[model samples]
Every structure is written in C-alpha cells, then in structure tokens.
Target: MSAPEGPTFRELAVQALSSVQHGYDLLAPKFDHTGYRTPASVLDSVTGALRGLGPFGSGLDVCCGTGAGMGVLRQVCRERITGVDFSAGMLAEGRARTPVAPDAPRTDWVRADVRALPFGPVFDLAVSFGAFGHFLPRELPGLFAQVHSVLRPGGTFAFPIGAPARPGSRHYWELLAFDTAMRVRNALWRPRFVMYYRTFRLAEVREELLRAGFEVELRALEELGRRADGSPRCRLVVATRPV
Candidate 1:
C-alpha cells in the first residue's frame, strides 16, 4: 500500500516526471523493495505452466526489469537466456543479482525496446512480467509482433494475466485511482508515461496475439487457486508461432 521504504513522495514525483527509462533507472536500486515488482508467486506459477512445454533451448525475457522473469527462464532453458530492457539502470541491477550456475544456461543483458526487438528468430521461448502496463493498447500489435519475430517457428511467448478486479472490491477503486492519476499526470507532463493498469484486458490481448500470427492458448494456473465464480485467479497466455 505504501511506497517503497526509500524514496519519499516528492522524490517519486520527480522520478515520475522524467521519461519512463529515466524514472526506472532512478528507481532501480529500490525497485525490488516496492510492491511494483512482480511477486514470486506469479513467477513460480508461470515457471510451472511453462515446464511441460519446455526443455527449451533458449529464452528471452522481454522488458525484463531487474530480471525476475529471467530467473524462471534459467530453470527451463538449457542453453542461453537473455534479458532485455530499455532501462540501463534496471538491467545493471539485474546483471548484478542474477545468479550464475556452472554449466548452466548463459545469460545476456540487452538494451532494446519491445516494439522493436533487435534479435532474429533465435529464441525458443520468450516471457515478460509486469511490464505490459507500460505499453498503450495501440502498441500491443507491434509489441507482440516483435516478440513473435524473434522466436523460431513453434517457439512460444508466455506471460501471466490476472483476473480483473471485482466491482466493489478495494482493489478496483485502487486501480481506478491509480489510472486516473496517471491520466492526469500525462496530461500535465511532457514525454508521458504509458502505464495504465486496466488497458491490458484478456480478450483484447488474445485478439492482438492472434493478429500478430500467434496461435494462442490460455492455461489457468490452478496453484494460484480460483475466484468465487470458479474462474482461475490468473492464467498464463501461451502464444506459439506456427512452425
């Protein structure tokens, strides 16, 4: 609920006023301490969901912030793993914290935009976490296309999507408030930040993935339990490029 331990409101305001890359760079040192970092539970669930599909040769963590998703890739990818982020600050922290294993898959940190990936069809698997909110809905097609381009035929791109907030729940209002604030900030600021909590809906996401030439499937992460309606609390959207 509270902002990360360090960085007061004024400091965060200053950071937010900057470009997204610069803001994250400034926040990198304390980024993991904040609740903004994807939780371990979500990461674990994604890892489990990808296990049966894998024994994959290479993996990429797109928009990898501080490399949490890279940790998951390390387990499933046998040969090499790459973490790419436009934020050098975040990538630096990721490079430092990521553990190295003897004879394990090699890891590389690259700086690139997801909408315009720099790699060819080289990766067997690609995953992203907690980074989609940074992209506008209009950007989804190109973003997914770029990821699709970098994967070999039959390769997969995976990421988790949580259920929408219930109408009357506190989380609903909290998200609404955050989005409203972001809109206000963008209106008043230059080089606006693109994070909008509600923009990435499941249906629209699936449509975009399909348009990008991926055959998409949703696998409910049962380990996260279910909502009152019996629907999964979260699902891993696995989109595979046709071979």
Candidate 2:
C-alpha cells in the first residue's frame, strides 16, 4: 500500500509516461512517501552488514535517489560521502532531506550518468539501493566497469538483491504484469521509461561482475529471513576491486 502522503494515481501515471530521469524529477518531492523509497529496515540491515566489513573512508552512492544510500554511507564512511545521479530534482530533495551534521563526513552530490562516472579511483566503498532495474542486462558489463573504475584498488561495491519471486505467487504475477505493461508502454511511447522488476538476475549479474574484474561474494541478509526452500530471501552482493 502507498503512503497516505504519496503521489496520487494520476501523478504516478504522469511519471510512468515520462522518461526515467524526468519522471524521477517529477516524483522527487513525494518519493520518500512512496513505497519506492528503500525501507528503513533494509537500510539498518545493510548498515549492520557493512559495519562488520567497514570503517571505510570515502564512499559513493550510485543512482542515489533522495539519499537513502547516503544515509548508509554516513554510518560506514569516515572521511567523505558522495551521491551521484542524473536527476537534479532528486538530488535537491536528497540534499534537503539529509542535512550534514557538524560531526558528519563531508557530503557532495554530483549530477552525471553512472554509465560514465566522472571520478577516478577515489572511493573506498560504494553502495546503491533499489535502482538497478533501470539498466538492461546487456548494459551490466559497461555499468559494472564504470563502477569498478571509480573505486580505489581493494575498495568495495555493494548492493542488495532480492530472490526471484516464486512462480505462481502473487508477487510473481505482479512483477510479470508490471514488466509487460512497461514493455508495451515503451513500444508505444516517445521517450521510453525504463524500469523492469524481473530483468536483474543474480547468475547473470555475478558473471558480469566477474568479467569486470571484481572478486565477488554473497552474504545472506539474514535479517530478511529465508524462503521456503531455505535460500535467503535477500542477499548482499559484495564486489571488491582488486588490491
């Protein structure tokens, strides 16, 4: 269910019709109220997971929409934190929502496409949340390459991914219907809005990350619990640039 303060159906419809960047810009104000924003529970779980591996220095949040990942970076990173995305509106909201405390690390926001990050090997850690659905499977190689390029040798790139919905489940059908609708909408629309729930699978993603020269590890987010088959319902993908 959507939050009472979240966007109305009409607002969501308008956003769905716009390009990804523009749609996010239009949705930025009400984004945190929507179910689209990463949940606090997930953020806290990630913080707990990364805390064990970290005490990292500078950190980056890729495709940071309204600063959810920035909050995670704040706890894990000691030196500085940067949030990057193509949407100015979303960045503005992020900045407003996440004010820098006197003792907090220096925070910066950069406007650029993640496909070609403008930084060198600078960050010690990086994290992203709920944003991977925008990229097609074929783009994973280049996307992971870009992420790999921006991290210092031995720096970590981490993100959470949910297990695929079980076949015939309500969630499975919901996701299938959503992707189908998006495909149809894109075929008929001018500026295509790209977002699909089913495209990012772990096996294909692991291969791409390996091809991009990162040592990969999977840690179950036990806080999220397990499936009936005893597999983790959510797992953290930890990819580290080689030292």
> What is each predicted model's overall lDDT from 0 to 1?
0.92, 0.95
Q: List the residue pairs that clash in candidate 2.
A: none
Task: Give the per-residue lDDT digits (tens) of candidate 2, residues 200-241.
Answer: 999999999999999999999999999988999899999999
Local accuracy of candidate 1 as per-residue lDDT tens digits, 75-187: 99999999999999999999999886797799999998878899999999999999999999998999999999999999999999999999889999999999999999999
Q: Pick the candidate with the highest TM-score.
A: 2
- The most accurate candidate by lDDT is 2
lDDT of 2: 0.95
lDDT measured at residue 72 in model 2 versus the true structure, 0 to 100: 97
Candidate 2, backbone clash total: 0
TM-score of candidate 1 against the unseen true structure: 0.97
